[model samples]
Target: MFEGLSHLARDAKAWPFEQARNLLARTLRIRLTDAERDLAVVLINSGKTAEAVATFPALAKPVILETGYGPSGLPHLGTFQEVARTTMVRAAFRSLTDDAVPTRLISFSDDMDGLRKIAPNLPNQAMLAEDMGKPLTVVRDPFGTHESFGAHNNARLQAFLDNFGFDYEFVSSTDCYRGGVFDKTLLVALERFDAIQKVMLPTLGEERRATYSPFLPISPKTGRVLQVPTLERHVDKGTIVFEDEDGTLTEVPVTGGHVKMQWKPDWALRWTALGIDYEMSGKDLIDSVKASNQICKALGGVPPEGFNYELFLDEQGQKISKTKGNGLTMDEWLTFGTPESLAYYIFQSPKSAKRLHRDVVPKAADEYLQQLDAYQRQEPAQQINNPVWHIHGGRPPQEGSPVSFSLLLNLVSAADAQDKAVLWGFLSRYIPGASPETHPLLDTLAGYAVAYYEDQIKPNKAFRAPDEKERAAMLDLRARLAAMPSDCQDAELIQNEVYSAGNDAGFDPLRSWFQALYEVLLGQSQGPRFGSFAAIFGLPRTLALMDEKLGG
Candidate 1:
C-alpha cells in the first residue's frame, strides 16, 4: 500500500498539491476528490480543522491542529505515534509549501481520566502494581500525591516524548482545560447532554446503567465524579462548574449553543473552538471520528479530517501500551541501539499497523550498527517515504575507526576524557591487526557504557553446543578462563585468560572463543567475537560475569 502511495507522494511534489487528492484513490480502495486527498494529508498532518483551513484559497488564520491523548497511564509507544505524526504533518506542510503556511500542534494529555488498567511494561512496574484495576481518575500517584493516576501517567508521557525528541507544546487537561478555554464547547456539549445520553446508553453493553453527567463519563459515576472543580455542573447558571470538595463552585463561562452535545458531537465542537484541521488517532476511534463528521454538518461547521493508523501488537498479541507494560520502552531500546532505528521502526508502517518484537537492543553494538546500515542503505521506495528520513537523511558515516563497544567505551569513560589518539588506536583493532571501517552508530557508544555491556551479559538461554569438536573446544576454553594470573587486571590479561580457557577446553583458540563463550554465557554456540565482547564490557564486569557463570 505504501509502495504505491510513495509514487503519488513523490509525484504530488510535482503536481499542484492536488496530487494528495489522487494519492490514496487506488490504495485505500476508495475514491476521493483532490480536495479530499489534500484534506487527508492536511488533516493527518494537522487535524480536521487544519485541513479545512489549508483548503481555503486565501489565508484566514494560522491553522490550528489540536493533538491530544487520554492520559490513562504513562505514555506508551502509542503516544509517540500521536505526537510524532502530528509533528511530521507540521514538518511536511512546511517542507511542501515552502513555509507559506504555518501549523500549530497542540497536544492534550487527558490527565483528568480515571485509571483503567495498568500498562504491563512501564519501567516502574512495582509502583503501578497497586493501581492495576483501579480508576485512573481516582488513583493516587506513586508519590502518594493528590494528583490522580492520569496526571502521573501524563508526566511519564511528557518525559517519554522529551526523551524521544518531539518538539510540541503539551497541555494537560488538569491545567489548560481547567482555565475554561473549552467552556463554550463544553456547554454546547452539555446542552446535547440528554440527546447524547440517549445516543450512548444503548451502546453500553448492559454493564452500564442509564446515567448522565453534564460532562462525558465513559462509565457511570458512582461516588465523587462531580467533586473536582473542572467536573461539576451548575444548574442555576446553565453551566458545568468545577469545584472543590467543600462545594466552592468554579464557574466556567459558556456560550454558542455550548449546552448540548455528546463525545462525538463535541469532537466537531472542539475542532471549531480550537480551529483544528487534522488529528491522527487509532482505528478504535473510527466511529467517533465518523460521528464528528456528521455533527459538523449539523452544527454548520466543517469536520476536521483524520487518518486512522493501526495499533502496535506486543509479543503476547496484546496491544502495546504504557498501561499494559508488555512492550519495549523508548529508554530501554535506546540503551542498545540508536534513536534512528526506533524512528525507522515506528515510521515504517502507516499509523494503524502493529509492530511486534521490534528489537531495540541487540547483544552488541556491531549488530545494531549493521541493522542501521541496512535500513540506511534500503531504497527510498522501501521506507514508504515517511518520517524516518525526516530523522536520519542517509548521511555518510562519521570519521572514525570501527572499534568494538568496550574499547570505544574505554576511550570515552577514560579518566582524562580527551584522548583522541588513544581512542583511534583502540578502534584500529576490528581488522586482524589494522583498524576496520567504523560504523556511524559507533559514536553513540560512550554514552551507553553500562547498558551495552549489561545487555551483552544477559544470559542467552537458547545456547547449544556445536559438534563434538566444538563442545570439546568450549570445555578447553572454560579451563583456560579458570586459570587467570593473580595480578592480571589489564584487558590483555583478560584476552589471554579467554585464550587459555579455549586451549584448556580443547578448541582452537581462534574465533572459537566467541562460540565457546556463547555456549558458556548464553548457552548459544555463536555470538559476537570474544575480543569485541570484552572491549565493550571491560575487564572487571566481564571477569565478574564469567566468575558468576563458571564459579572459577
Candidate 2:
C-alpha cells in the first residue's frame, strides 16, 4: 500500500534556505486570524502532524493549494490574479508556522478540455474550426510552435507564470490522465456513478441530465470525446460501456487513460485524490462548488476549503472575459505598470469585484508606491496589513526614494521625456544628484508614465479656456511661482503658495480654485498634488506651463 505524501513534499522542501532565513529574521508578529487557525486545526485533525515542540507549527502535513486555468485563450490579468492571491495566502500561512510546514501551489491548466469554439484572438481560426469538439491535445498549433494547440497555450501560460518567478508546480490535465495519475480516482467515480449523478443532476437542465454520464470516453474511431449516454458499468472490472458518436455501443476500460470525467465530477475527484487543502474560484461558480463539495463527500473524501472571489469587471462593468478581450492583457498591464502594482490590486478585498482597465492603472501603481513608502515609516506592527508586506512576502523591501506615479506622469508630460535617462535628467533637478540606479522604482515609474502619457493622456490634451476669474487666478499663480526661491520650492512651500494665489484671485479657496488650476495647467480636472508636481517639474518649468496655459 502506498502511503500518500503531498507531491510538494516529495519534490521540494518547505522553502529554500534563503527564504527560511528571511522568515526567521523578521521580528514583526503576524497573528493568525481565527479562520486561518482553523485551517491548521483541520490539518491536525486529518492526522498529519510533526513532533510536539514548545510552539506548534501550523500543520504537520504539507498544505496543497491549487488554481486552475482553462487554456482556451491567451493568459490575461484575471489568470494572474488567482496565482497571485493564492501565493499571498501561502505567505500568510508561513507567518503562523515555525517555517517547517511545506506548502505548494499547483498552477493547473485544463488543456485536455475539448475545443468547443474557436477563440476570437487565435490565429488560423479555420484550422481550429476543423478540430472543434476534439481535445485541445489533438488540435494542431496554428502558430506551429508546439505539437498541439494545448502545448502552445501551455507554453504561453508557463512563460507568463515564470516571468513573475511564481513558486508553483505546473500540472496538465492531459498528462494527469495519460500518465495514469488519475486512474484510482477514475475507478472510484465509475463505481459510485449513480451517487455522483444524484448530486449533480438537480442543478443541470433536464435536457443535459437526460444524456449526461459522469465519464466521457475519447472516441477511438473519431478521436473526439464522446458524451453519449452510459449503457452499462462494470465497477469491479473498472470498465464502462457507452454509446459512441456513431451510435455504436463501445466498452472501454475506465483506467489506463481510456476516459476522463466531466468537469464537476473531475473537480471533486481531483480534490479527493490530490488532497488539496485550499482552492479558489470566481463567485459565478458557487453552485458548481456546492455540487462538487457534495460529490466529494459522497466519494468519502473531504472537500478542500474554498474561496469565492468576485469577477473582474471591464470599464463598462461587464465581466472580464478572456474571449472578449475587453480587459487589459498581462502584457498591457506590465507595460504600463509594475508587477507589484498588479499584485497589490489582487491583494485588495478579495471578495469584492474590482474594475481592471487603463483608467485604473495610475492609481493602483501610486497606491503600491505609497504602501512601499509606508513599510519604511510605519512600525513593524503597523506594517502587517500593508499590501507591500504581503506583496513582498513578509520581508518587505527597504523603501528607497518614494515617487508617486501621478507625479512621474506629470514630470514626463512636462519634460516630454521618452526614456529613463531623459526623465532622470528632470528628476535629478529635484533630488540634486539622484540617478536611475539610486531610485529604481522612480526609474521604472518614469518608463510607465511615458507610456501612459502617450496612450492615456496625450490624446485627451484639451486645456480648458478658464473664465475671467480663473485667468486672474492663473496669472496670480504664475507670479507667485516665479518669485519663489529655487532652493525653497519644496512640495510644502509650493503647495502653500498655490493656495495663496487662489485666495488672491478672489475665488472660493476650497472648491473651484485648485480644480481650475489643474484644468488650466494639466488639462485634467485633478492631478498630482500641485505642490509635488511643482517640486518635481521644477519651479521654472512650472512657471512656463502656467504662462503657456494663460496665453502669456
Candidate 3:
C-alpha cells in the first residue's frame, strides 16, 4: 500500500522497519465496516465459490468492473448508487493490489432490449406508445436530439456520470450486437441452447415455457423482437428457426444483430463476451444473478463475482420504480445537496435498504460535512474507516467547512438572506478573511442553504411565543450575554452562560430549555448549537434580535 515512501532514510533508527510493519499490518487488516471493502472481495471472491475461483479471470487478466443500465428511462439516483459504489469497490481493489493490477469500469447500456412500456417520467408519450415491443434503439428520441430514445437516454446517463466525475467507458448493447462484438458469444450460446434452457425452463409458467427460447429473434417482417417458440436450432450454422408473429417460420443467424437472448441468457452472454470480473446488482436481481451464473457455466464461461445490494424505498417505502416515477431523481438531489454529499450517502451500508427522498438530503449533507471535519484529526487506521476517505478515494481534500448545513439554513432564515451574497456578507464578518475564493465549499453551501431555506425550511417554519417562565429565562440569558465583552465571540463561553441562565431559571430537563430556544428563536423544534450560532451571528446583533423576539 505504501510503495514510494522514503521512510527508510528517516533520522530515527529502525523507523523504516516500524513504518513498514504498520503498513503491512494495515494491508492485512482489510476488514473494515466500509461497504466497499466487502464489495471489493469480488476481485478476490468469485461468485458462490461453488466451483473454486482458482481460474477466475480477475486473478490473471486486467479486472473489468461492469455496471448495467436499462435505457428505458432517465438514470435515477439508484443508478448513480450502483456506479458510485462500483467505483468505490474499484478504489478499494486498487488499494489492495497496490495499484499494480489494471482495471476498467464498463457502463453497459441495454439499448437493444425491447421497449416493454413507456416511461412516465419521459416526454413525447405518444411517440413511445407506438414503439412498444421494438428495441429501444429503434424508438424515436423524444428529446429530438439523439438518433433514438435509447441513444438519448444513453447520452443523458453519460452526462449524469460525467457530471459526477465517474471513470467509466460507456457501451451500447445495440453496438455490441450489430458490430459483431458478441458474435462468438452468441454462437457459444446457440451451441449450448438446451443447456441454457435447462437452467431457465422450470422457472417459467406453462404459457411462458411453451414459447421460451434463449434467443428472441428480431422479426425480418415486423422489426419487433418476437417471443414465439423456436422451431429448430442449427448449431453449426449459428442460426435459429423461429415462428414469427404471422405464423410463417423464419430462419435467422444468431450473430450480427439478428437475435438477442432473454434477460438471464443475455446477462450470461455479456459476461462470457466481455470477461467481466465484478458487477453489483440490486436485491431484486438475486434470482436472475443466480440463473445467469448457471447459464454462464453452461456456456463454458465463468460468471463474474458481484455484490447484491438492497433496493431503495421511496417516500411511501415502496420500491423505487423507473416507470412509476416514485423515486427521487438524481437531479432533485443535486438541487438541494452537493454531489459529495450524495456520494457519502451511497458510501454507507449497502445491505440495508434506505429511504430515498428529498427529505433525506439534508441529513446526508450534514453527515458528510461531519465526516470531512473529523477526517483531519483521525489516525491512518481510523481514516480508512471514515467514509470521507473512500468518498475522496483515499486522499481527502484539505479544505473543509466546519459550519454545518443546518447552521447555514438557520442563518439564512434568521438573516432573511435571499441569496448567497447576503449569506456571504454575514460569513465575511463571522470568519474574517474567509472569502468565497478561499473556502469554496462553504460558499457553495451558502447557495444550497438559500435554496433549501426557500424550498424546505421557510414554509415549515412556525415560531412560538415563549411562556412566562421561559420568557424570564430568555430575559436572563439576554442580560447575561449583554454583560459579556462586546468583542468576545467565544461559542463555548457563550454556551456556558446560556446554560447557567436556563439552570438558574429553575427549568428542569435541560433539553427542554434548548428545545424552547429552538422553537421560540429559530422557528424550529431543533437547531445548531445556539452558542455557535450566536457567536457566528455576532453577539450584539443576537442580543438585539432577542429583544425583538422577547417583545422587550
Candidate 4:
C-alpha cells in the first residue's frame, strides 16, 4: 500500500526504512489504537480537528504536541513515559500524513509554579524551607548545579530526554511569563477574569473559592508568588488589584512576569497563548483537563485534545511519586535494563494503569527482544502492531539478540558467573560466531544481566533440594538431555523432552514441576523457559549441573 513509504523513513532495509514504509503505508487506511487511529483518519481526511485538536487548524497552522513537567523533583520514569508516549503519537501522526503535516512537540516545564512544600527526598531542607512560597524559578538550587531549583531540575529533565533522543523543544513557564511571550494571553485572561473564575471557583473548596484569583501576582516585597484575592480587575490597564498579606492593596500588570495565573488558568492560558494542538496527561489530571478546556474556551481558544493515560503505580498500588522516590527511576532501569526495553515498557498499555517496580525490568527486556525478533518476519500491518516499531519510531534495530535477558540471568546463576567474560564464555558456546561486537544487543544485555544478577537475583537465590517426585523428574530430564545430540540447537525439541520427564513423573499442575526445577537447579523461585535455558546454556552443562544438585 505504501510504495514510496520506505523512502520517507530512511531509504534502507536496515530498520531505517520501516518508519517511512509505515508512514507511506499510512496513506492508505491505517488502523491503530482507538484514539490515535481516529486522530489519524481525521487528519488524513483533512476534517475539523476541534474534537481531536489540529488538523489543518486555522488553514495553515502546524500540528503541535505538548508534554508538561513539574520541577518539584528530579525527573522520573513517569516523566520519561510521558515524553516517549507523546513522541509515539507524533510519529504515528506523521506516518498518516506522510510528513505533509508538520508536527512539533513541546516539553514544557512549569517553573513559574510555587513550591508548596519541600520534597522529603531533596537535600538541604533548611535552605528550601526558607524559600517556601517563592516561584520555583527563584528558589535556590539545592543541588548547586544551576541558577535555581527549577533550572537544576529542568537541566536534568533535558539531559534525560536528550539521552533518549526525543524530538521536542524545551519551553520554560518562567521564560514565557517574563519574556512577554505570554503577555497577550495574560491580557486576555485579565479581560475575562470573571469568566475564568466561573470555571475555577466551583472546582475549589469554600476557603479557596473565597480567596481565589486567576492572577497570582509575584509579591513585590518578598519576591514570593502570592495567592491572595483580587480586589479589582483593570482590564483596560491590563492589571489586577490584589491585597497582600499585610492588608495592603497592590496593583500589578498581568504582563511581563509581574503576575502568573493559578494552575488551571495557567494551563488554559498556555493553550491559548501557544496555540497548542494536542497534549496528554495522567488520569489524575482529568478534572484539570476539563477545567482547562472550559477556561481555554472562555479565553477564546480551543483546548488541546488528547487522552488521559492511567497513572503509574508503585509496587504497592500507590501512585508513583517523583519527589518521594517511591518507584523505579529511569536511571535505575538503565543500570540493568536496555534503553529499548525500558521504552517498550513505556509504550505498552499507556492508557492502562501499570505497576512500576524493579522486577518488571528483566521481563521488559525479554519482551522487547521478543518483539524486535518478531518484527523482522512481520509484514507492515503486523509490524506496526508491535511496540518495538513505535519504540524505535519505526526504525528498530535489525539484529536480534541471540539470548533472552532472563535466560542470560539464569545462565549466569547456573554457571555462578560473576563477570561478563564468564557469561560470555557460555554464550560463545550457545551461539557460535556470536561476539560482543557481532551481537550488540546481547553485548548490552550481558552487562545488564551481570548487574541484575548481583542486585536482584543472586542475593535472593534460594536453591532447595527437589522433593521425591521432582527429584525423579529432574533425573529423568537430565538423562533425556544427556542422550540428546551434542550439536542439538532446537529449543522447543529440548523443551518437549523436559516436559515429557515432568509429565511422565506425574506432575499434575506442571507449574509445580517447573517450580521444582527452578528451586533445585537455578536456586530461584522462577526462571526462563526450561527448554530455552537448556538450549542456550548447553544441554551437557545443564545435565552436569542437575547431577551435582541431585548428588549423582
Candidate 5:
C-alpha cells in the first residue's frame, strides 16, 4: 500500500508530454509514432535536463514556427492555408501554455530567387524567364517594371496576414542572409566545406550524392536546370572544382555553389543557422524535410521542429494552386464574406487533409457570430480554468431578419407607405412566376444590389423614371389587380387578376410593365411581374417607389 501510494504520487507528477497523444488526436487529428512521442517528451522540456527538471517544475512545451510564404503571384487558398495553420497553432500553443508564454512565428519569403515561368495561364507569361535555377527575386524582365514582382507577391502575402490576423515576423532571405543574420551559420558551414563537397558531389559508384546539382545554370527558355559556369564564392573566398565530360577535371573559380544548397541541405542549414523551432511546409517538401534532418546531424545542429500540411484541393480534387488559375483568390472570397469565415474554413479542417467543396460557409458565419454572442452572454464561470469555447453549435451568435437585397433596394427608393413592399416586389420581379427563397449567391447579389442603388439609382434618377408608355402599363396592371375578386388569396389568383385588368385598361402590356419594373428595380432589361410584387410589397409603397423614381 505504501509502494502504491508512492507510485501514484510519481505518476501524478508526469510531464505535459503525457498529454501529447490526446492533444494530437483532438487538435491535429493525427496519431504519433512511439519515437515521435518520446521526442516530444524531450522537446517539451528541451534544453532542460533531469537536474533542472528536479529543481523546477515546467509545462510540456514546443517552440512553434512555420514556413513563410514566397512573394510570388496572387496567393491561392493553399498559401493562405499555411498562414491560417500557423495562426491557429500559435493559438494552440497559447492555449496549452495557459497564455503565459509568448509563442514565436517566423515567415520566410524567398524573394532573392529568380522568377521561373509557372502557371501556364498566368498573365504576362513572357515576363517569366525559362529558368528554374534563378531566384525569383533576382530575375527581371525587359520592361523597367512598375513594382518588383517580388513586391507584388509581398502585397498579396500581406493581404492574407491582415485577413487572418497572424502575428509573425517576416524574413526575406535576400535581406536576412545578406545582412549577416546567418553569417555565423554560413561560416560554420564553410568550415565543413570539404565535408559538404564530398556529400554534394561524389565519384560515380563510390557513393550516391544525396544532394542534387548545386551549380546548375537556369534554362531561360524551358526554365529547366542546366549546369552553368561558376563564380567566386562571395562568402568564403574559396573556389570549387567540377568534373566535365569524359572524366576530365576542371577547376572552377570558387564562386557560390552553382546551385543554391539543394532544398535538403538548405533546409537543415537555415534551421541550424536561424535556430528556428518549428516550420509547417507543403506536403511536396516532405522528402526534402526528411533529407534535411539527416543533413542537420551532419551540420552539427538538431533539426528544427516541423509539420507538413496538405494542399488545398479545388472542387475538382486537383491541388489548389495559383498556377492552376482555377483556385479562388483571397480577394474573391472576401467579396462574398468576411475574413473570419475564411479562417473558420481553414481552422475547422485538419491541416494535412484536403477540404472538399461544400456550401457550409453561411452556416460557418452564423456560427462564428453565435460564438461571439455566447461569449458575451456568459456570466463569469465558477470554474477558473474552464476552456473557452471556439464555436457554439454552428449557429449565428446574433439574429438577423431574413431580408433580401430586393427589399432593401425598394425601401431605399420608396416615397411612402405604398412603397413598403417596393423592395420585395422588386426582388419578386427577378423570379419567374415564382422566386427562389434562397439564392445560391445571395451575398454577392446583395452586394450588386447595394452598389447599383448607391452608384446608379441615386445618380441616374432621370434615367430611372419610366416615360409615359411605362407609366400607362404600370397603372393598367394596378387596375387589373384591383378588379380581382376579394376572395383571391393565392399567387395564381393575383396573376390572373393583373393580366385581365391590363387588357380591360386597354394597356394589354403586362410584359412591358415587367420590363419597366426590371429596369427600375434592378437596372436590368426584364423582371418579375410588377403587379404581383407590388401587391406583396404593398400597393402604396410600390407606387411611392414609382413616384420617387420619377421625381427623387
Candidate 6:
C-alpha cells in the first residue's frame, strides 16, 4: 500500500499527501464490532451513561476508570499500556456522550506494599537488603531523590505520565493509609475477616493457608510489615493481637494506620471504598481478581466492571519482568518513537498477547503516521473509526508530510546522515521546498531514525558478499540507474530496470530478483520496496550506493 503511494508521489513530482490520505481512508478504516457494541451497552446500563453516549452519542454519567501500579520498580512500557488503553476507552466514552458527562482517571500506586525482595535495578542494593519485608514507604531512597524508594518510583511514574499529557489523579497507597483514608475500609475488612478468608483461603495452597491472615500488622520493633498469624481479633475494639519480631505479644489497632490487609482483601476493600467504576488486570491475575470480587461482595459492595488484558512478552516470547529487566523501557521507546505510536501499540487488539521490543518500534511509528495521514483526509464517519482520533482525544493534529519510519531509516543509511539537518538536506532534494517547520512529523521521524540506526540497526548490520550472478546484476542495475534521466519518474523507472536486470540475470522477477536486491543492499531477505526507496533516496544517490555495494 505504501509502495504504491510512493510511486504516485514520484510520478506526480509531489508528495501526493492527498492520495496517501485517500489510500488510508479506503484501507485503514474501523468500526465497532458486535462485542464492542455489547460492551458499550453494558457501560450504559452500568451508569457510564456519558461513555455510552460518546461511543454510540445518541445514547449518555460520570465514570471512574482506575489503573493500578506497583512502585517496587521503575514504571515500564506495561505500565504505560494500561494507562493508554484506559484513556482510549475513556475517549470512546466521550465519543458516546454529551460534553457535560464527567470522567476521571485514577492512577493508583501501591506504595504501601511490603518490599518482599530487593529490586535488582536499584542502586545501593545492600541498603535495600536490610529493609526487606518493610513497607516500601519506609525504605530509604537509594538515589536520595525522594523521601522513600516508593516515593522516588512514584515520581518517575508521574513524570512519564505528565510527558504524555495525561490528566489523572495520582493516589499513593501510603498516603491513603497514613491519612486514615482507609480507616473505615480497614474496619470493615477486620469485622468481616472470617467471610473474606473463606473467599481467599480456598485459592491458596496448604502451606500458604497456614500463614494467611487478612490483616498484616506492621512490627513496631523491626519496622517490617509482618504476615504472621493473628492471635486474637477484637472486632469491638478494632485491634488485633500479634507477636512482634521480638517474640513479644502486642495489641495494635487495625485502623488508623497500624495495619494493612493482604493484597486480595485490600483490593476488594479498595473497590468498595473508592466506588471504582472500571478497572483492569493482567490475565495472570484472573483468579486473584475473582477472589477479590467475591470478598467485595462479602463486604456488601459490587466489584467494578473490567477486562483482563494479556501480558506482554519479550521478543523471545518470555514474560516481561521488572526483576529480569528483560524488555523495552519507557525511555528507550520515547527516544526512538513518538508517544502516539506507543499509544497505538497499546490500542491494537489489546486483549491479545503482543511482543514489546525494540524491533517493533519502526512498524508502530509508521502505523501511527499512517493513521495521522488518514485521519486528516477522512470524512467524519471514517474519522470516528481512525484510532488516531481516539488517541488524540478526538482532536488529532493536522497532517504533516507522509514520511514513513522505514523510509527515514533507509535514508539515514543511504546518506550516512548523523542528524536531522543532514537528513533534511537529502529530503529537500526529493521533496522540493520542504522544511522542518513544514513537516514536523517527518522531521521528528528523521531524528528517531538516526537514533534507532545508531542503537539498533548499525550494530548488527551485515552486508552479504554477492555471488557472481548477483554481483553482475547489481553492477548492471547501477549502470541502468546512472543512465536514467535525473528528472524521470524514478519509482517506475527503477522498477522497470530491476525487472530488466532480473531477466538479464536469468532470475525470476517475482521472487529471486527482489530477494537478491534486499540481501545485497539491506542484508535482509525482505525490506521496504526497493523501487520506492530508490525514488525517495534519489536516482544518483541510489546508483552510488549500488556501486559502493558492487565494489566498483
Using lDDT as the measure, which candidate wins? Answer: 4
- In angstroms, the error of model 1 at 547 is 21
TM-score of 5: 0.53
lDDT tens digits, residue span 58-96, model 3: 333467789999998778877888898887776655554
Q: Could you tell which candidate, 1 or 3, scores higher by lDDT?
A: 3
Model 5: how large is the Cα RMSD against the reference?
13.1
List the candidate numbers ranked by lDDT, top first. Answer: 4, 3, 6, 2, 1, 5
**lDDT of all predictions:** 0.50, 0.75, 0.80, 0.80, 0.49, 0.76
- Candidate 6 lDDT for residue 163: 83
Estimated TM-score for each candidate = 0.58, 0.88, 0.88, 0.88, 0.53, 0.85
Off by over 4 Å in 4: 1-60, 120-124, 322-325, 485-493
Candidate 2 structure lDDT: 0.75
Q: Which stretches of candidate 3 lie over 4 Å from their true place?
A: 1-60, 120-126, 506-508
Runs in model 6 lying further than 4 Å from the true structure: 1-61, 467-476, 489-493, 496-511
Position 281, candidate 5: lDDT? 77
Model 6, span 91-149: residue lDDT tens: 55444332334568899999988998775667999999998988898999999989999
Cα lDDT for residue 429, candidate 2: 78
User: Between 1 and 5, whose lDDT is larger?
Assistant: 1
Off by over 4 Å in 5: 1-64, 118-134, 141-148, 190-211, 214-239, 242-259, 355-360, 370-552
Give the per-residue lDDT digits (tens) of candidate 2, residues 375-416.
788864456567786787767778644568888887777676
**For all the candidates, what are their Cα RMSDs to the real structure?**
10.3, 7.0, 7.2, 5.9, 13.1, 8.7
* Candidate 5 local lDDT, residue 465: 66
